[model samples]
Target: MNVSLILIILLIGALATYMVGDKFASKIALLFGLVSLGASILLLNHYNLGENIGLFTQWIAKPNISFALQADGLALAMLLLTTALTPIIIFSSFGTEVKNAKTFYALILFMAFAMAGTFLAADGLLYYIFWELALLPIYFIALVWGNGDAEERKKAVVKFFIYTLAGSLFMLIGFVYLYQKAGSLLIEDLYQLNLNGTEQIWLFAAFFLAYAIKIPIIPFHTWQASVYQKAPTVGTMLLSGIMLKMGLYSVIRWQLPIVPFAAKAHVTIMLVLGIAGVVYGSIVALKQKDLKKLLAYSSLAHVGLIAAGAYTLTTDGMSGAVLQMIAHGFVVVGLFFAAEIIFRRYDTRTIADMGGIRSQAPKFTSLFLILVLASVALPGTFNFVGEFTVLYSLSQVNMGFAIVGGTTIILGAYYMLKMFQSVMLGETNAKPFADVTANEGIVLVVIISVLFFFGLYPKPIVELIAPSIEEIVNQINRIK
Candidate 1:
């Protein structure tokens, strides 16, 4: 029941890396990342499966909040995603020269720790604290080591930090209201609170603002494209890979259950908005000259559909959302790293300025093409499974809505393929191009393996999370 081990190991890993000199910082951080990933993997063994693994103790007598960490199937799936990705994230940065390497890598580990804590927390206040802690490291990562003009970077970083922090405050107020109503901050206590329809609406909005800002659904997403483009590729990976999922996971775990009536009442228009993001982000992406920003907007489109699936309140939709989060995470990171590889070689990210790479580097071209297919959710790729499941869930709800949402597949293919052709194919560039290195080859191989492995056999994940998603649906229905 000591799921806190993941947090402790990660935090200690961050500190231990700092105590060691900069010479070995990245190596040490990667070691710790692997160690944490090992622990989570061990937990997934059948022997360790059953009752929730948690550490619970009293921390504050006044507020009645406990130092609590709970891990169930849903939480464990997220923990697995975070822990598994952190190592790849660490591995992804090994070749780059990072100043103050200790600090930079430590923040990455700390970010993992905070995100893991967010997934495992059983107390409302504890969850909020971990949620906010997740923001600080990425803020620094983007501010200090991020790319682009100094003034522009500062503006984007500050705007992102302030926007998300402001959203958190509203969520905090919602938690506090639930606390007052329930007389305790335990999630179970909050779940049992007998709030009225009016109260539920307020709580739902507050919590939605927090999650939506992080997910950056639409209007609240002003900071997403800028910060993503300005941040280092690894930072962008962290943001796209695991950070955005926190908001999405919260929507399913925290918001919907606490305010089921509000969720039920407002879900139609909210879903329409989610579908709107799909159209808006795609059309915007179609016009993007910058590779990173195009990927960012494409991400907005992908997550919009996931958000819409979540609010459907159907078992199939919730299951698809969880599945899609994992799918999107791996695909997005691979895509960003592909962009980073291009930047490393060509010193540019503009799609218009690139061509004929496939002629020189067949290996890199093949990998990039695979990711492009995965992103567009080509049949037999991992994303297609989640996308199909979600679209099916939507179809069950409203065939027309599913049809609108389904256009992402078409639009996704149109833009991603155009970018792929512009950058990876066609007439030779005057500049020389090198094929994928052993390191880059290994990373891409791992990514492709993961996408296809579950792409073909997603039963393990589906079985793991299905019961929990069904429980959540039941919870939503039972709310008074």
Candidate 2:
């Protein structure tokens, strides 16, 4: 079947799952997710380098926008990540008991649609619509089903909503200004528009705020820890695994080329902030007792390095940032899922409360250990491939920045291994616990296989994304 037809069927399946009620909704969602994954793979296989496919058109008059979708290497990579994770997220939810399973499954499918739209959209307004649309379902999912105290959940959700929305408003202003200047909402048109240095600076700041809040660089990251701590395991998985990359992707797609001069001029300060965030997040995570909170801080550190790499504008840096985005998405989800399994068994998330779990759950301990190693960027894991590329790229820009960024590996290992030792080792003193269940084992095994497979053979992904990075770099060079 054609791409458009496949998308339509998936959308229908999403709605149908919502209508089908609780009993079979999850199964239907899983079925549609698999179909979407298949379609994404087919699109990737058929992807032609230097070719653009115009999927559809909308808004003929007044700005000349189109419902256009293309399968460039960058878009395809993100599509693969999204599709691959959807079913895993769905399956992970098997351990969760939601009030209305149908609504829950529907939300997951709808999130998939929104994410696909964000990657595929070729128009600025359309992309922004999908971007904002993606936030609502997740907000509800977290607020309704999140763990922790009731008030804390509410506060976390509200803080996340407000922070993201505030940033989004700036993005909206930036896009509107682009539309006014370029007389079109097409992303390509914006790239060609010539703006003065002043305009570029202002527009860049506006766009930066939006993406930073989402990637959540240092100061803007206050909301993320609590939100991650409060969110249900599946919710946390989706937020960390797939959603955060939306911001990183936007920085590459929208901000850089459109305002290359501004980005280049202020890249030093941005790099400083990135380095600070990396160090600060790692140190803070080292002290976190809650597993989710620790993971949240670790995510902050990872994205800070990614933001630093994006600003470097070097080919290796950009490509590494992209690869890291995909790698972190998978690795973070696996870690969070492992945390969820522990939480489910012991009914607690505090490290001090968990002890001797490895004695009772050997498979769980083994899987968690592998995931921890991946998180710390051990060799033969995808995280190692991504971090090596990113750090090497950063070193090309500044040895100091690379040195600071490298500290994350040390701090990451300190915290992760400490957590593992606390939870997975020591004398048996806790209530009875089961080993990793079949579903959990499957989820983790898939993640591990992908992690090692990509780690050992990352050339395919590098080849796929390099062309787009080259295109973007060429655009920035034109401005220079």
- On lDDT, the leading prediction is 1
Give a tens-digit lDDT track for model 1, residues 317-368: 9899999999999999999999998888888888877899999999999999
For candidate 2, give the lDDT of residue 209: 93
Estimate the overall C-alpha local distance difference test score of candidate 1.
0.91
Worst 10 residues of 1 by lDDT: 44-53
Off by over 4 Å in 2: 1-9, 48-51
Q: Highest TM-score: give the candidate number.
A: 1
Candidate 2 lDDT over 192-239, as tens digits, reads 988999999999999999988888887888888999999888888888
Candidate 2 residue pairs that clash: none
Backbone clash count for every predicted candidate, in the order shown? 0, 0
Q: TM-score per candidate, in order? A: 0.98, 0.98
